[model samples]
Target: MASIDMDAFAADWIAAWNSHDLNRIIAHYGSDIVFLSPIAEKLMGNGKVAGLDRLRRYWTAGLASQTDLKFELLHVLRGHECLTILYRNHKQQIVAETLEFDGDGKIQRAFACYQLEQG
Candidate 1:
């Protein structure tokens, strides 16, 4: 993961979400991906989504619901075997999307955390 170029990754990631293309967006993930988010909990009866098939379904539903979906990259944090993307989504919500990479540099686990809504 340390060998990965974050500039390229971030650009491609932002592009993938902005394009609203499922295949492109999912390309960076591994087959055994595990995704977690508060939104997932609301939509899937839990915060965890395991496996590629389930991830596809979860993201598809999200995309369908948020027709104006888009994300703006704000920051990128790289770590050992992990990286985090900080961005603002279509709803103007800030998200810290932390991803753990498999040995092959594919994302195997992810957690999306939101900034508390302003009062």
Candidate 2:
């Protein structure tokens, strides 16, 4: 098996997200991908999202609430076939989200911590 290049994968992941193409975004993940978000009222898995149909809804709903979605990659940790990312988001508010990816260059897990800033 080929070793996973966390840096390149992480970069591509961020690019895909910035593209805002849900289909292209999902195409990067494995079948059993898991998504966790502070905004998502419910945690989600691939089973919950059989295909792009539900993924679109999830993406739309998750991003619609935020005005500006700017992300800066702070760090990258590489595991056997996983990547852990530390990033900060600058939107109408400032927030941080941790993104983790599995073997297939897909997001297996995520943690989003967000708080509104006043200034």
- Give the whole-model CA lDDT for all candidates, comma-separated: 0.91, 0.59
lDDT of 2 by residue, 1-104 (tens): 14556677677767767666666777765555555554554545432443345556777765665446556776776555455665666654445445555655
Model 1 TM: 0.95
What tens-digit string does per-residue lDDT give for candidate 1 at 1-119? 66789868888988999999999999999999999899999999999999999999999998998889999999999888888999998889899999899989899999999998999
For model 2, the stretches where C-alpha displacement exceeds 4 angstroms are 42-53, 64-67, 92-105, 109-119
Collision pairs in model 1: none
Per-model TM against the reference: 0.95, 0.64
At residue 84, candidate 1 shows an lDDT of: 92
- Model 2, backbone clash pairs (residues 3+ apart or across chains), number: 0
lDDT of 2 at 51: 36
Q: Give the top-scoring candidate (lDDT).
A: 1
